[model samples]
Target chain A: MRIELALFASLEPYLPEGESASGRRTRMIDLPGGITVGEVVARLGLPDQPRVCFIDGRGVREDAVLTDGVRLAIFPPVAGG
Target chain B: MGSLLRVDMACLTVKKEPVPAGWAKYAGRALTDAIIFAEVPPKADPLGPANKLVLAPGLFGGTPAPNGGRLSIGAKSPLTGGIKESNVGGQFAHSAAKAGLAAIIIEGRPADPKALYALDIDAQGNGMLNRVDDLAGLGNYETAEKLHAMKGDDKLVTVTNGPAGEMLMKAAGIAVSDPHGYPNRFAGRGGLGAVMGSKGLKAITIPLGIESLPHADKEAFTAAVRKFANALKEHPVSGQGLPTYGTNVLANIINEAGGYPTRNFSEGRFEGVEKISGETMREITLERGGNVKHGCHTGCVIQCSRYYVHPDGSYWTKGSEYESVWALGADCGIDDMDGIAELDRKCGDLGLDTIEMGNVIAVYMESGKAEFGDVQGALAALEECAKGTETGRILGDGAEATGMAFGVERIPVVKHQAMPAYDPRPIQGIGVTYATSTQGADHTAGYSITANVLGVGGTVDPLKPLGQAELSKNLQIATAMLDSFGLCIFVAFPVLDIPAAFEAIYEMATAHTGDPWDADALMKLGRETIAFERLFNESAGFTAADDRLPAWMLTEKLPPHNSVFTVTDAELDSVHDFVAETAAEMGISKP
Candidate 1:
């Protein structure tokens, strides 16, 4: 399965090399079928920190499964207007 | 322990009276709301002589305590037709407190409606209202510059209104001087500026004084201040995330959560979210040599404010915050960052509430006056507002009026005030706050987003109705207390998670006021304050039915999650059950 992933704010540094300077990046990547969000984060070597994750604009937990064509976005903790 | 200054527009008199013994702990919103409830008649016309405008600082204002420089401006709102206390971050509060003023009350309307005057407070906090009709037509920036010159003090803070306010537009907000002497910081909600303008008051210049705020125990106060500042420095949200990206950082996260209101709330997400996200803002601002980290006033550790720049590296305006960005950009279907910044600048200069104006313009678009994403049309509508044309009047009045003029549904307002960035359908907890808040659709009144979305204090399912009422109730109580202290709302981030930080608030207040305050006393004060506001609203004819989301929000489902606002009406009413409970405890009979 293939999915689009976007990392924002401080998490942008974990994006593929040469794309981290923008402070945000979106890229398509291949993933195994029915892979959980936590496994993808670990496989991609993303930092082990508290984050807000979403699959196709719906907030999801780390254990939530992702399928093909989903757009995944992750951001570091943030609050305020 | 400063004096209260009363200025009568009808008599052109300025009187000084010692701060009431009972008002020792009252500053910011508490002081303002108390004054309004005690003095103004409940049914008084918001724009008439019977109305009064009160300006107050927090208990910590002008102190060495970090992030204590906030002002609360209150009145009977022309927009919401309810009691209003709009808070702003600026130098005016610090200067007023340093000048030995607890509050400034403006009363009566000028006999000549077209007359204008400027209220000047000297180093001794003695106020004098001087006739200054020349300032009548000036914008906020020009008004601040002119008042700054008239005062002849480099550190003088000017609070002024623009043409929108002079026109008595309900969307107008009063602008306060920032550190740079720019009238950028705003008490920017509830049509308080219209109240100010109706008084024939053009500007108020207050000098930053040399004296220090008296403390009950300077040593204890110093120690508490240190703990609070250090806690703010240590908190991730305050120390790092905010300083790095500013508040707009929430744009992507909120959009990802499907809570971001888009295209006048016809949708829940914007396709152009990335372009207007905080990450993009930081990159653009830094590339243009603009400041990505700035403070609105002194003693601010978070420094979440910023300066936006033009492509040529020249200053454009203050960086739009998350609310402004979403209100003017996504809600209006515009994605041009530069365009949004330009619109923000216009709103600031015109002394209009950017949130209110944006929502109104979106309603205008729905009426087919212009299409969504028509940046030029939106700009032209603002120009019309400045000129006070017929169409401009409709837009200037706010979202509901514009919707009525265009015969459009889905106004997205509660109590006639426009909603902020979040759509309540997907974010149910915030909806509860919006429906029941005394101030009318103000997010800061409760900010359930802290738990529902940000996971600041704790996590509550944003889409779930359970536990939302309790969450909003507790938050609203804490917020009322926070506003009374004049502490920045950002301080709540640390106070929520850091035990020392929460303890330090009461410690600092106790030492500063010598009132022997504790956490319980402060929370009771919060409850009592809210109860009075409720009483005033009830006297003004608002009933439980007024505490409800618009019919569309309850009936129509928002996209992405396809969720309707599911919080029951009973749950919404329960958020304010404290009003009656507090009244009973305080021995005040409820009407």
Candidate 2:
């Protein structure tokens, strides 16, 4: 399945070499037909720290299963008003 | 010794007194709280002649501490009728410290209501209180520019109020000059500006030059400062996240958590989140040829401030931060960035609290005074405040009054002060702080989010009601200590996780002040600061009943998160017990 993953702020430093810049990265990976959102974070080598992940615009838990051709956004340490 | 400058408005007298012994133990908010407790009588009206306004710089303000130029302004709030401490960042603290002044106390209102006075302190430590007529009715921006022109250099630091303050509006705030002569930074909250206005004072200006004070161990201080700065550079939030995105970064996160208050606390999410989030702001600024990250004062490493520009690269606004964005954008149901920018500009010009002003307008909208998503109507409301019109009078009365006027029951406030952007139903820990803090509903009173997130062993999940009261108690005490040091709360992000970094800074303070102390001693001082404020509030007729969230929070359930503020009254009462136990652990008795 193919999907796009984007990182922001300090999380950009943890991205793979070719995908470390300021845009989205397209990657293809083999899955067991269906995989949970937790598996996607682990597969991308993202931090294991608890954080909110967004699929398109809605919040989804790490255990929620993902589908092909979805856009994922990963964030680190929430901060706001 | 750092001296106190006292200005008596009625007599036009100025006195400088040496700093009292043991005051060095507490700085910033702690010091201001102590002073307010010692001098002002509780029964006195906040707008009456007996009330006093106290301003104190943080402990590390003059030094090269990262994000350390925070100033605390304490007074009896005209709006809340409780003890209040409002903190802001500006050049005033650095200048005041350079001039060897510990705090500025203004007391005794002028007998004449029409006369306006300006207080100026020169390099020789001598102060001049003059009656300046040209400053009357001038907005903050124009007042600052005229004062700068009158002083004829960048040597003077001016703090002024707009028509909102001059008109004695309950939501008024004092504006301080930014580095670029823009009156952007503000001591905003609790209607302290109205207190100043009631005194018949227009502004306070300090003219300072480069001067160094004596240090106990310069080498040790330098070494500890360098180590602390290095530690900050290593942390993600302090090192990069804050510098890159400022506090606006939380818009998306809060929206995702379903905790972002939208449209008068009706929902927890806003559909136009993308336009107001930090990422979008950075992108928009870049496209508009503006600087995304800028520092507030000298020696600040975490430059979370920014200069927002328009499409033509014109100066649209300065320091368009997170609270202002949420208050003026999401809460008011206005999604246009240009409209938000214009509102920010108007708030700056009028010397008003953006949070209170925005919330007041939303109340007006709810009452059918204006329609939802009416950006032009919002602008017109701000214009009324600038011109001091009849509608402006209603708008300047703050959230509680506006809510009362409109008969809106969903008003989000605690202690008569408007709550900040964070809705407490989902994040219950902050709700605890808002309820218990002496400064009324303030988010920065104790920002326990970091400690809670790091799972610092005893902390509870924000989503759960269990142990949140105790957690908030600890955070409030710790934050009081940080505020006393005059250190920026942002330093706590790193200092909490790595205690050694803060220890080094504490050692430096002890070495400089020649006071025998450790971390435990600092915590004791924080407790004392809180006790003093509590005492003041108690004397001012505030019982435990006054320390609570608005009724709507308990009865209403915020959507998406589907969480109601489940912390009961008994749990809230236990918070005071937790504070008392902490004091006992430190071998201190209750005040």
Candidate 3:
């Protein structure tokens, strides 16, 4: 089972070296079956304080269950006028 | 107290006066609105002699407050026919504050038709207005270059208008200096630029100074400033996200939320959003040798501004921020990033408000004056605007003018000004602000985007009208207070979420004034200002009927969520009722 991890804004730096920091998708990562959203973030070692991860465009908590082929996107807090 | 300069353009006279006793504590919008309410007749033609232009810096300016250098330009708006207080981030306000000057008031039009005046604060520390005959009809960039060259110093801070203003175009904005001496920051709304142009004054310059204005409690102010800085640094939005991707970061987030306002607001999202998202902009900026970590003024920790460069590596413009990007790119059906940046540069050169200018261009496209997705045609229209051609002059005024000229009935405007980056139908909170703002569809006037979209203060559903009235009212009052202190509105993010963050602001503001101040005092100040503005608008003929979304917003349901501006007319009227109640609490009598 594989869950595609996408990063946006400052959170993109935590992705693998070949992964792009902005719009273009660099590569997809394969995660173990039955992985929780929290487990994926912990594996990436991204900062815990400033991240909002979305699954299929809906925001999910750390305890949210991940399914195969789910497109997960993460971003840091961004507020502007 | 800081001094005020009264520049009487009609007689070509300049006077220095002590700050009025009653206005001693006011700054920014609060200060400007007070002066306008007292001196300007509500019925005065905005481009006529009776109208006056007031420019003021925020209270924390010349201090250590991060992003505290915002300047507020206020007048009777030629576009909205209502009071306007437009804010800009730049070095002009900061420099004026350092020189112990709080505000500059330009009153009366020139006696001579073509007499162009330039106000200069000399190295000897004396300020004077001079007639510069050669500077007539120059672009903003050319004007900045000529002024800097004539001054022969890198310390010149200038606020000037460009050809759009000279043409008396309603969308004109005053350009202020960035840290690098570029004229990029703008008080960019409500046709205030046309007021400046009518005066026949081109630029006002404040010489750079080293001395800091003394605070009543220096030690306490310093400590409080430190606390506030710490608060900003710790916030992920201010400290990291903005510095990393700039304000354009919202392109992706808003698009993802299905509230991006594309193609004359016919749709809620853009298909080509990824091409112009902040993430893509950042990568492109780096590839093109641009500086993404720049601020509009000094001491801005949340460097949400960026300077873009051409593909050939030469500088283009300082920014095409989220709103400008949306107005030009998605709103017009053009998704080209470079073309959008070029349009931003053109607007800056013309000293036009990009948001308003884009709205007009989009309306023109809707009327078949130009084709959708025609970046070159849009650029050509801007060129004609600068040239002041017949068609150019009509479109230059604003969206309403373009709509009328083209005989297009589906014009999206409130109180004669164009709707900004957000479509109020999907983002109902902002829509409430648009229909009801004193300044006419200004997003920053009462930004409910925090609650509706970003979840900064509290969660309010973007799709539903539930609890939106209260949310907009609270934000408008708080935002009014923040503008008075000269603190960047971005600080409200942390101040909203963290008690200590707000306490730091409260402490810093109160400590500097050496007065006993609290949340109630601040709220009172905001409420009174609102009452005063409302009175001015009322005298200018604004009614509850004027505070309404365009008819299309009610009948035309937005996509994705299929939401109209569900916030009813009664609910929208409630926002002002709260202001009136607060005004009554503060002993402010409505006119």
Better of 2 and 3 by lDDT: 3
Q: Give a tens-digit lDDT track for model 1, residues B1-591.
A: 888999999999999998776767788898998899889998999999999999999988889888898999999999999999999998889889988888999999889989999998987889998989998878998888887787677777889989899999999999998888878898999998899999999899888666678798999999999999999988888888999999999998888888889989998888888899988999999999998887888778889999899999987888889999899899999999999998999999999999999999898888889989988988998999989999898899999999998899879899999999999999998999899999889899998888888878988899999999999999899989989888889988888888999999999998888889898988987898798799999999899999999998877888888999999888888888778778887566532
Candidate 1: tens digits of C-alpha lDDT, residues A5-74: 8888888878764322223488777888989999988987887667778888767789999999888888
Which residue runs does candidate 3 get wrong by more than 4 Å?
Answer: A1-6, A13-46, A53-73, B123-126, B585-591
Clashes in model 2: which pairs?
A79-B250, B58-B486, B59-B485, B59-B486
Colliding pairs, model 3: none
Instruction: List the candidate numbers ranked by TM-score, top first.
Output: 1, 3, 2
Q: Tell me the chain A TM-score of model 2.
A: 0.72
**lDDT per residue, candidate 3, B1-591, as tens digits?**
688888898777787788888787798889998889888999999999999999888888777777787888899999999999998988877787887778889999888978888988653335688987688889889999999999898868888889899889999999998888899988899988799999998998877666666778888888988888888888888888788888888887776566788877788878888888888888899998888887788878778888888998788998688888888899899999999999999999999998998899888999998998899999999998988999999999999999999987767789998988877877889989888889888889788878777767877877789998999888888888888878788888888887777888778887777877787878777877788799889999999999998898898877766778888888989898866675576465543
TM-score, per-candidate, Cα-based: 0.97, 0.92, 0.94
Q: Rank the candidates by lDDT, best first.
A: 1, 3, 2
Tell me the tens digit of each residue's lDDT in model 2 across B1-591. 478899899898999997777666667887788787778888788989888998888877566666667888989889889888888887888777778778888999887889998888876556778887778989888888888888897656788988888899989999887767678888889888898898888888886456645567788777777888887777667777788888888776666556778988888889887778787788788888988777776677878888889889888888478888888999988878878988988888887899998898888888888886789988888888878888788789898888887788888888888888878887788888888888888888877555433232234566678877877787778778878777777777777667776787677686566667688887776777777777778788888888889887887888876778877888777666644554455343422
Greater-TM-score candidate between 1 and 3: 1
Q: State which candidate has the highest DockQ.
A: 1
Ten-residue stretch with the least lDDT total in model 1 chain A: A15-24
